[model samples]
Target: MYSRIGLTGDVMLGRLVDQYHQQRPVVAVWGDLLDQLRALDGLFINLECCLSNRGEPWQRTQRAFHFRADPDWAVPALERAGVDCCALANNHILDFEEEALRDTLDHLDARNIAYAGAGRTRAEAFEPALVTVNELDVAFVSFTDNTPEYAATETSPGTAYVEIDIGDEETRAAVQETLNRAREHDPDLVIASLHWGPNMVEEPPDTFQKFGRWLIDEGVDIIHGHSAHIFQGIEVYRGRPILYDTGDFVDDYAVDERLRNDRSFLFEVVVSPTGDLSELRLQPTEIHDRSVHEADDEAAKWSRGRMRDLSTPFGTSFERDGEQLVVDFNS
Candidate 1:
């Protein structure tokens, strides 16, 4: 048996999505991608913002941006899209502070949505969110290397974090220990969803690559990385897939033409029951009118070329299969 998993980058249902919901249901924004998403055995996305109407913004210092959504609106949107699991380990998960984070957790639980990374305590934040699909136990572990201030403490509610600075031994040890504990669950497949790296950069840093390899060495079957709003290269380390950065999946933010942050992909990974990867494909996507749609021909060509350039260095290439981009893993 094989499980087909659908993965996406930062999905912020607040702001524009909230405003758009006033006109129509949130699932309408998914456009033609909705049916494709529904066919997957599992779909995991980075919940980039809190889902609560309460809690004050962090006031110690001014933040460039903060995001939140009314649970009444956000919950239904997620349900309509058939989102099975979400990674709550990003920098913005606690934008509205502890109360909102707690509410977000409660809201997801009430809807039977599983989330990993952020929780009311340190242990909860590090624990894997497990779900059985196709009789295979799939585990998701999330962490952010971006904002330490949002990190969970022994008693506070926050996100799970791994220090980004390569030389930070203490933080590295903490991340390794968390992964080790997650491995003890012995799931059929483990996905390490890491919210790391800088935004808008095309290539990842050496430390980021090394850290991804380290996680794979520690038994993580997949490395789902985000934060760079643009897609990065894909590295298959020892047959396990490492999505260096998936780019922005759905957001209402203004796009920078130069960065091409709007260019994105819906990554699909097929894994056998024995935990071996069988196929990897990419659905070229673009953000339009606050919804996700298949990329146009011109946009598709550009995205395919960009991915080719980025993945060439790692010995990975892609072939255009109709509208989708298929990874040439056998190459």
Candidate 2:
């Protein structure tokens, strides 16, 4: 009766990626990882784009990018990969303005795919998305620290945004308030899907690390972090796993030669029937031609080595189990 849930970082289905889908199949974005993703009991992703065919790019500030995917193909592509829920608190969610954000919400709603973070109003944006994974009820609360301009107000449509600094009493209180809101769902597990920090940074700053640990101490079962285009280390605080940054799952961004932003892991967490997290399995993956697939030999080797080196400083270790890097909780 064990259940497995898949988690991924930014999955952008706009711009060139959307163009590629026009010529390829709906499942082409996921490549060989499609079957594995479909096999999970539930899957959560940081959806990095709006799903809509309307609306103009935001010109409020000096924003340089606007990402909007046609729901006709994007929705089906998400369904093909068995995406159960999405975190929509990233900077790009409202890149195309409120109309596109509303469209994204409507499309996900129509497909029965739950989402948290950006919403029509502040209350809805701060609300958690609940989903059942087997017999376990899991809750997801999302937030972003990068886009304060996109922060939801009382009656306006926007993202759930917050500043992360555990040292500051206000920020600590804010984090507690967010967790308190999610706790109202009475879920078996709570995941704080955070889209924070700058892009392409390999290591998280000390402030972020402190904040992540503080969130765990406050009650979050897992800290699912992203927004850094490159993957960071995995840290297990107490018994909960903190995925600092999962990197870009599917996108058309320019690759950083040194950081290898094109490579990351498809994370799977195994939960015992009792709802306790048992183990974590990371399947290395690489992005090419706007498609994501299981990493080949050289890429896999690089992924494993990089992940190990990054995680080692945190006192975290991994054991390779066939093609997957495993972190056993029971041991």
Candidate 3:
């Protein structure tokens, strides 16, 4: 059988969501998936929010969001469902400050749940995450555009973020850190799970695409990005599939009537022992109650049709935003 890997967009487990009257019911929805797919070997999610029951508000920002959990029911709810790996490279991971971030990491470690993205120091931040399956080693690296001053440093704790300036030498060096790890392991595959761009842009800008290609040229096997909150489109570049945004995987963002009804896809990637992504499968889905559900035949057809349009302008091709289709680049 081929290797089965599940890649989700973003997830936030915290107080604000659990208080919803139907949290338990939502848990039941995911529980079924865990039982069915646990034996598949790998499950990965972008942990969009931080979970902690500690620390003072680090920033004096008048308006901010922090995701807190009761600490008791949260991990069990997640782990019992068989989520093996988490990407902590999103903007919200540092909402609770360093202390809470540490606590969250402590809990995940105690549960034997693997995580990447933020770390106590620069070395820790850019270190590649590892998952061994069927004797193949897979490395995961995560980054974010949301962190303000909570970015990685040689001496402090924080998330790994990219910097584009020569003056910001620290952030530039962090990239080298991850690059070195990528070369050292030379695993069966390497995935850079970066949280970037605006919340609902239909596609990546020129700069984003440029960075994607740069990372690919740097020996990355897959460039998986999120933070658009909505599914944008996917592109097959140089024999590798680049998913611009996978949308929100799981959360209580269900009330957005528009997003709740968008046609989404669960990216299923099949890899060979040599780390080649030999197959790409889109598990068409529909968003309901802020969660994802497998689509019936009719919905599947509709989703496939939309995706075909979305994928058309991927390679140097882009459509201007608004009422009509205007191609700006040659495909």
The best candidate in terms of lDDT: 2
Question: Local error of candidate 3 at 308, Å?
Answer: 2.1
- Per-candidate TM-score against the hidden true structure: 0.96, 0.98, 0.84
User: TM-score-based ranking, best first?
Assistant: 2, 1, 3
Kindly report which residue stretches of model 1 are placed more than 4 angstroms away from their true locations once superposed: 165-167, 328-331
**Per-residue lDDT of model 2, residues 119-168, tens digit only:** 99988998889999999999898988988999888988999888877777
Count of backbone clashes, every candidate in sequence: 0, 0, 1
Question: Candidate 1 — which pairs collide?
Answer: none
- Which candidate gets the maximum TM-score versus the true structure? 2
Off by over 4 Å in 3: 21-32, 164-173, 254-263, 286-291, 296-302, 315-331
Q: Judge candidate 3 at residue 307 and give its lDDT.
A: 60
lDDT (Cα atoms) of all candidates against the true structure: 0.85, 0.92, 0.68
Candidate 1 Cα lDDT to native? 0.85
